[model samples]
Target chain A: MAEVVTNLSRKEQVIRMAAELFKEKGYSAASMRDLAQKLGIEAASLYSHIKSKEEILRTLCFDMAAEFRTSLSEVEKQNVSASEKLRLGIIGHVKVMAKDLTASAVFMNEHRHLSQPWLRDFLLLRINYINRFKTIIEQGVSTGDFKKDIDTKLAVMTLFSSLNWMPGWFNPDSTIEPEKLGQQLADMLINGLKQNA
Target chain B: MAEVVTNLSRKEQVIRMAAELFKEKGYSAASMRDLAQKLGIEAASLYSHIKSKEEILRTLCFDMAAEFRTSLSEVEKQNVSASEKLRLGIIGHVKVMAKDLTASAVFMNEHRHLSQPWLRDFLLLRINYINRFKTIIEQGVSTGDFKKDIDTKLAVMTLFSSLNWMPGWFNPDSTIEPEKLGQQLADMLINGLKQNA
Candidate 1:
């Protein structure tokens, strides 16, 4: 599990361990028994904490999505220039990824295993989140903060892809603060979108 | 499969379907028998072309890695400004991804299933590939074609993260040609890195 890096949580041991297991074995292949064995808890005790594997995955996906939504809304509320708003947005997203590296990786990679109504809701949550970004870019362009000619959809995707790949590489104990890392990342992407003086 | 998106191949039917199945079921969970059933062929017939499931994955990862290496070497041979070279390099990569969407998706997602030696070799190939992009950005910086103050490592990673997420969202029947799409992506990224004229 990524160089024996599984002990990523203390109080939330079950959720983190299941995230690691789900990440390792894929959601469908991993059993409650396996998770229980890893946690040294009985399957019945595990059942008390969580209903099913899918429920855990659902919680991670929606909770992370909600965090992102909340972060974006917080950034949007600031009375900053459109460019600064975008920079802060990038930082906010990176902070979310840095806060829970394993869970973020699980959300990014294993969320596909989520079932019907949950999957639909997850997709809706995701699209609405992305749409808010588009609005930010649109406002940035209109205010001359960004290049008027930039493709809003591609730019937003580029911003996300740049920001979302963080968990694949970020170290859990790296000295670089998440906010500073976010600042550098924001500098890179926002500079690309920024209009010339 | 991704919303009934599995019919993504023709001549290389076995490999493509395997990629899809591997993507859906994860390489560990998917079996030779399942692959044979999906292919409408006998198990022996499946073995005649591919020795094992891991062997199929090895071919995908190494072959795609080789393609990327070849593309980088080809771009390096061209005598152009570093920024233009970078743009062409990006186009080369996007064309590779766009050429075989399903296989590329599988390569990105399922390469982790590769065993030890293959995994080590894959990592080396990837780092070397990434290093080439870093050198290009470095040269772009040295030539005063890019911002002198940029973090080269972060900038290269940003370029890759921006490019590597294509399979997640790019439509198989996208109206945008890979080259043109590559052009826009290159413009967005390079402008971010470009020195003020």
Candidate 2:
């Protein structure tokens, strides 16, 4: 676990610890003092790196959104078939979630606690991210890669729900690796979406 | 919407209003007073029908769990192919969620706030429900109707995730109906799981 945090700056470390605290105690219940105590620092020192708990939540949410965009853009750039793009896209999504389990989990579950402009901004980023996935599926549909009658929005939501729900049930200790799980799920979804058996 | 609440007793009406409040404001941020304000009643009167905000949440969680169990049990009793059973099961699950959107959403998101014994009990029911779905898929594999190599747990997680994630996005006014969504999703999943797909 120490290796996971190694080479990170102090601010990065604080955000990481705050993510874990938020995941454990939830965003509303987790206090700045608790986050500081977890890092073996005073509450005053904690504020130097991060302004508030919601700031940590906002960072996690935006960072996860950025990670998804990075993952999708890489897949989008490949000249492979749309089917291949989707499989690769799912694998990339899972990799990001695996890379930072706590931050991603907190991002998934606790972003609802963010208030006002930040919440609006985070949600806009999220919508843009979802639209990116929809774009892939829409391309697939237009290319006759997926079912002709496919509802792109429904398919995208379904695909994402399978991947996004990972944070809730994913076992970091599980023997099944993220890429393998992602590959299998991608295959399953593609089989469903394919124009023909 | 008034007609929706017309048949219920006063206590049942309180729980329904609370579910909407919880869905809108979230469980922690929502208060008994807000619920009363929504219903145009005294906060003290709100207590007469439901003892606490958590009480309404507990009722919703347990009741939704029961609905799922009932849905699954009905599907389980069907004298049909495992594939058909799975399809019916999903349709039933969707109907339950669609029937009471707000309560189902609260059940999905806010059950994390439940206290020890109730939380433990709710989780147990949930695990049992999930396993029941697994059993259906396992039966499909045993019957040679599904991919023998299927990771039943992964397949189940993927399937449930698609349906469970619905509360966050489902539009009651959508032209596409719940049963239709369930059927299409079930078809996609089955295609993914079919041995020869």
Pick by lDDT: which candidate is best?
Answer: 2
Write one digit per residue (lDDT tens) for candidate 2, span B72-177.
Answer: 9988988998888999999899999999888888988888889999999999999999999999999999999998888899899999999988988889988888
Each prediction's RMSD over C-alphas, in Å, is 6.1, 3.7
TM-score for the B chain of model 1:
0.89
Fnat per candidate, as a fraction, reads 0.67, 0.58
Residue-level lDDT tens digits of model 2 in A1-197: 77546634788989988888888777877888898899998999987777776778888888888888888888888998888888899999999999888888888878888899988988898888888788878888899988888878888888888888888888999988889988888988898888776
Clashing pairs in 1: none
For model 2 chain A, give the 10-residue run with minimal summed lDDT.
Answer: A1-10
Off by over 4 Å in 1: A1-11, A28-34, A41-45, B1-11, B29-34, B42-45
lDDT of 1 at A57: 90
Report the number of backbone clashes for model 2: 0
Tell me the tens digit of each residue's lDDT in model 1 across A1-197: 75335433432678888888877766767788999899897777876666677778987887788888899999988999888888898889999888887788888888777879888888888889888888889999999889989989999998888887888877778889999999999887877778772
User: Against the native chain B, what TM-score does each candidate's chain B reach?
Assistant: 0.89, 0.92
Instruction: Name the weakest run of 10 consecutive residues (lDDT summed) in model 1 chain B.
Output: B3-12
Enumerate the candidates' DockQ scores in order: 0.52, 0.62
